[model samples]
Target chain A: MTELTRIIELFQLPFMQRALLGGILTGLMGGMLGSFTILRQLSFFSDALGHSALLGISIGLLIGINPSVVLLPFAVCFALGVTYLLERTRLWTDALLNIIYSSSLAIAVIVLSFVGQYKGGLNNLLFGDILAVRELDLVFSGLLLIACTVFIGLTLRTQMLLTLHEPLAIARGVSVSAQRTAFIVLLSLVVGISIKAIGVLLVSAFVVIPACAARLLSRTFTNYVVLSAGLGALSAVAGMLISAAFNLPSGPSIVATQLVIFLTTMALPQLRALGHG
Target chain B: MREIVLSVEQLTVYRETYAAVQDVSFSLESGIDTAIVGPNGAGKSTLVQAILGILPRQSGDVFILGQPLSCRGSLAPAIRQQIAYLPQNFLFDRRIPMTVEELVGLGWDKLGFQLPWKDHRKRRHAIREALVRVDAAHLMHKMISGLSGGETKRVLLAYCLVRPRRLLILDEAPAGLDVRGESEFYQLLYQLKREQGWAILQISHDLDMVRRHCDRVICLNRTLLCQGTPEVALSSDNLSAAYGSEFVRYRHRH
Candidate 1:
């Protein structure tokens, strides 16, 4: 078969199509939420949430249930828990984040150890076997993407800006607490769905690297979101191509592509003046 | 007498076990410019935060335009829509990608009723008008992270002005501005007060500007020390009570 035909054949399989759809949806949500994440200096928090999802997913597998369903509530609970700890506790936020990040990973490893591995078991969530993604995963991710987009687009002007400067937002009559809670829930949802494509270990890279690259190129916050989404989509496509050609793992290849984009943007002099390097 | 726009009755704010502000009572008339002056750590910011519903109130009631301020429910947003606040510290991450125009446009985001004029052009026009009012129109397209301290303060003030809120509360709004910038800012404040009939409550350390610009002053040192015209409130006893003997002497020297 020719290259195009082979590529078509790869996607013609139900699993490959599911993986592609999942990646695209995750990219859109990541790009949308990632702008606020980077602006609020919560990149570490995103990573923490991603790792926390692993523990949730592993626990789901241990109970013989669908991992995604189990993982959503677990991730949201963890996200709210972290938010409360950061707001109420005396500990510095970064220190608290690091503790949660490592502990979640450790818990996942312990849980996975108890659940004896079958062939391509945890690897599906780690490296992401694009050839094995189910149709249900595709449908769920699409719905999530649409919901996130509508909510974000509706409150884009007020709520997103609130994360940038909360006190100001409060002063202007924006529901500071409500906006924050909604944002955290949305972030949790994004983290929960993204684990299937980028995996728990590398999901943060997908959210952060594209936004960081776009930050260097854009002048306004609106432009930054658009550029980040564009970059993220571009990286997903490129990574898929590279993975197909070299038979590399899809998740790592995607992350590697994003890093390359980040580095290139960092080196550009025009972007350096914008202080994104 | 004009109607009271803001009334604080037995207002108290506590930080953990310690009482930061205690039984502070004041009634600010509509269209009046009131200055809040006190030494650092005297709880000026705490009082402001309490009034804005950001801090938990230990006791007492805050009424804005005859409505009791509720910390929860839609009342908070309703009260907030009528008031604009400028925080003591205005810090943004240098990595954030936003321009002056976008920042100012955020002021209209809280108009939650979905007015017919939600179009981008209308929003842009409102932002541009606000910037021009503060003499920051030229910097509309400038990146926020690149602006100087004085410029940033101006932009923030512009942000506050974009919405036609009845009460404008500013905490050290001109703290870091140079003499000219400070003078120009207060001039703009005077214009806003006279032309738009805005009621302004500001916390300021600059005694001269307080004396020259504000109609009344409220001195605080954990409790209400004095409230009246600048000369009356800045009396030696009140100054000493709020700022200690060192500030009293410093004021006399100047």
Candidate 2:
């Protein structure tokens, strides 16, 4: 079979099909929420949440529960704690996120050392094994996607206003605190679900890269959001196909694909300018 | 008779441990334009933030249209919604792709948890009317990120005008504009105040503008130093007390 046909054949397998579905769902969720994350300058916060997932996974391994299940609540609480500190303590955002990111990572490493036969399991989570994605994982991703979609769809305008100018949004009575907390909660959930398909190391790339690409190409906010979702899904599928074709690691391949898209977007304006010149 | 629209009583706000504004009290009535004047660090912005409940006040009571908007450290949202505020700086990420029309639409009076089922035509008309009122109708379709400083101010003013407000508070709304631009902006604001009977409260540094357009002035230097008609409040003695030796040089320069 030709290379393209061979890649298609790989995707025809049931396990590959599951992996593709999980990736697409994760991509959609990440892309939609990532726009807000990027706009609110919460990219570092999202990265910290992703890194902190390792602690959740390590704890689950210690307790003999599925890491994925444990990660959901762990991430939610982590995000809420960070949000509370940010609101109450008034520390600079980067300072707090950096402290959380580094500390969580250190604790996770120490915990992982205690986990017997941890090498294989840790590698799978850090780099991801899309072929190992189970049906239950896909279901969780689907439900989370729906929850995010409904919440974002219902509050798009108000969320947009808040993202653009928070003080004005507050003055206009947009329930800024409640909406922000809801957003952070949804983001943590997305990070938890996404860590399975994208891996802890590359998950933020999955979340932020497509949105950055979309911003480079979009002319309006609505266009930016829709394009972000589109680019995310497109990158995930393309990355999976590349992974299958090259027999490469799925998570890093997906992130690499997203970077390629971002670079292409960054270069488009220049290319157009060159053409005009 | 014009009713009192905003009342701030014994308002005290602190930054860290020091009182930034102390025992400041003022009331604004409909059809009267009021200005707050003070030197730098006199708690002009802090007073506004405290009254708007953006900042936690040490002790204060802020009422709008007879309803308590804030008491001590707590703010009532329903009461605060009645007042429109134009902050000194309209801060946002420049890369955001919002349009002037979209920005103004965010100020629509009916913004709530319900789906936006309001009449689209009426909403569009209101947005257009607000932009036109600010001489920014031509900018409705333009991206907010691409707007110039003056255009941004006009668009923000249009945002405040999109909804009915019991009181309008502007925090140095004309700070960066040229002398002509400042005069014209104040003129437009005065016209809006006259037409809508808006209780206008603004923070300003231009003594000339305060003397010309404001019905009353409140001078501050950590505490209320003066509050009266511009003639009394902007008197040399009161100016000296609020601004210290700096005002004498500033007054002589003008």
* TM-score, prediction 2: 0.93
* Local distance difference test values of all predictions, in order: 0.81, 0.84
lDDT of 2 by residue, A1-277 (tens): 6998998888899999998998888888899999888989899888899898999999998888888789899999999999999988788999988898899999988887788787556777887677788998888888988988888877877888889877666666567778989999999998988887777888898779999999998767877887898888999999998889999988888889999999999999899999999
Top candidate, metric lDDT: 2
Clash pairs, model 1 backbone: none
Identify the leading candidate in terms of DockQ.
1
DockQ of 1: 0.56
* Per-residue C-alpha lDDT of model 1 across residues A175-203, encoded as one tens digit per residue: 77677788888888888777876778788
**Candidate 2: global Cα-lDDT?**
0.84
TM-score of every prediction relative to native: 0.93, 0.93
TM-score of model number 1 = 0.93
* Native-referenced TM-scores of chain A, all candidate models: 0.90, 0.96
